[model samples]
Target: MSGTELTVTLSGGSAADARAVVQALEPTFGAADERPGDDGATVHTATFEHEAADRPSDGASADAARLSAPVTVTVQGTPEAVEKASATLSRTFTTRDQGAASGDQEQERELLLEP
Candidate 1:
């Protein structure tokens, strides 16, 4: 399927906090492939299908949305996908521009999400 791949790297948080963010994203991005990072960090990588950004018709419940700890999310894909994902993430977390560096095939934006 045509879609974007997003890698969310969470550091300086407990495993529970990392998992909470991953769980919040799963309904939208599907199951993520999680791995450990240095110094008790967690990294979650997932691909979002093109339609994944569409808001649910029934609306999302408040309990389904949450985030915590310091995390850095890197979204890489077409400009459209990157923008969509960034917007979605911004709503849930306090984000600052880490950077946006582009290459020939794709573009990437780094956002730091604060607790």
Candidate 2:
């Protein structure tokens, strides 16, 4: 299964909440390359190798769906993976644009997970 490399950045939430998000994403994206920011922010970056015709498993998807905190997430990937990730995450986290006029070149999207 050829997959695109992606990065997911998480910030603006408690450390525990941020960890939970990383835990949720691990099954699908594998172990994250974590970077803890100043204060209580954390970034979990990984690549997801999902089949072209498949969505992420419900179990793995729901891991993030269970969060009820306000955490911001940024995903960078191919258009398809970005869209799929946004939709999957929106099931539990509130999503919005990163306010970039054009995301075509960067292939990045950002979202805020509400508590």
Candidate 3:
């Protein structure tokens, strides 16, 4: 175990939907917290914790969900990788009027991104 932790909170997403998104990003040792049904938008939160990664210090995770506006994603990695991963995840995960419409798509998305 690397004894490392990464936490991220995102607004504008449904809890259920957000959960699905977090579930996609396989964290070494992390989980996603989603809060839905808030003024037509949803809120999603995700935490990444990996203690046994090859490079335990470089643990990273991404979470995203449907939103009234654009989806928000927060990623945390090692001090050095955090910034790069965060920027990439933020840009890649953030979306407007976009989301997975089917279970298969959602699953596929998760499989593609999760660690």
Candidate 4:
């Protein structure tokens, strides 16, 4: 099994909402080290449990979501499967964040496999 860690920084949304989105994509991405949240679903940490930060501007409406966290997904399979999983995770998160913009943007870590 090969392990890859990706720290994803999601901004411009509510912490609760963003966490829900990430949790939703977990099954499609890979197994998580640990996950929290039920029904409303907010808060998830996979494997290493990357740090998360919620930054909300006073002027920003309460509906907005701000998320910054590292998600480390580990998959067991050929290199192709691992790569596919990475791409799938990135695309899924990006797709969901598209409709959730209040001038909010999602940031992805440039370096992969780094501690």
Candidate 5:
């Protein structure tokens, strides 16, 4: 992770759906340090670094990826990072902010995403 790091956990959808959501974030957040795996896990996880102000897809459209089903994404990191990730994801998918919780230095936000 080069800058602010955040780990994104996704579930309630096929593995492919999970990967699509993560890839959708690549333009703004940069490619993830840890990419979503092809393993047949019910829950998929990936880590990304926010290369602040280095967004390659400045006006990137959400045409890069699409979901086959609803997926729940949980982003864990500093409050700022979590918020940023949620915002970026929302631009691509129809999402509902399920909820959020914060610890001393870290926060977790869950978003229910629909195609």
Candidate 6:
């Protein structure tokens, strides 16, 4: 874990869709902490630790992975981190801003993703 910690939460999609959403953010956030298996649950969450705005990737394609259906993603972290994650995800998916809540230490933004 690094200084800027971001938590990504997914809902309203299949397990594969959830994984794709998580993987899409990796190019900017780096590999997330031990990705927990989804127990066929409705909500899945992953935490990522980032050092800077964008992480260094190995030329991996983050755009090929596609979602089977619509997904709602909630990114929680510092304002900078949430903004970066949202922007990165929007580039990979058709995203619409749902809403966001912010505090002194952390902020959370929710976006709807369509396949």
Clash pairs, candidate 5, are none
Using lDDT, give the best candidate's number: 6
TM agreement with the true structure for every prediction: 0.63, 0.64, 0.42, 0.32, 0.84, 0.86
Count of clashes in candidate 3: 4
Among residues 3 or more apart in sequence or in different chains, the pairs in candidate 6 whose N, CA or C atoms overlap within 3 Å are: none
Per-residue lDDT over 1-115 for candidate 1, one digit per residue giving the tens place of the 0 to 100 score: 4554655555545565556555555555555665332345355554544345553322222453455467776777766666656666666556788899787877788887777
Q: List model 5 lDDT by residue over 1-115, tens digit each.
A: 3477789999987877887887777776777776666787888888886764456444334664478888999999987778767887887788999999999999999999997
True-vs-predicted CA distance for residue 12, candidate 6, Å: 0.9
Q: Point to the candidate with the largest TM-score.
A: 6
12-57: candidate 2 lDDT, tens digit per residue: 6666667666666555455566634345335544455545234353
lDDT score, candidate 5 = 0.79
Off by over 4 Å in 3: 27-42, 55-69, 80-115
RMSD of each: 4.1, 3.9, 11.8, 14.6, 2.5, 2.7
CA lDDT, every model vs. true structure: 0.59, 0.60, 0.40, 0.34, 0.79, 0.81
Candidate 3 pairs with clashing backbones: 1-51, 2-51, 13-42, 29-49
Tell me the lDDT of model 1 at 75.
78
> What C-alpha lDDT, on a 0 to 100 scale, does residue 101 get in candidate 4?
16
Candidate 2: regions farther than 4 A off: 27-57, 61-63, 66-68, 97-106
Segments in model 5 whose C-alpha atoms lie over 4 Å from true places: 53-61
Candidate 4 residues 7-94, lDDT tens each? Answer: 3332333445445434543444443454443444333333422211121112222222223443333332333333343454454443
Segments of candidate 4 deviating more than 4 angstroms:
31-115
The residue-level lDDT of candidate 3 at 99 comes to 27
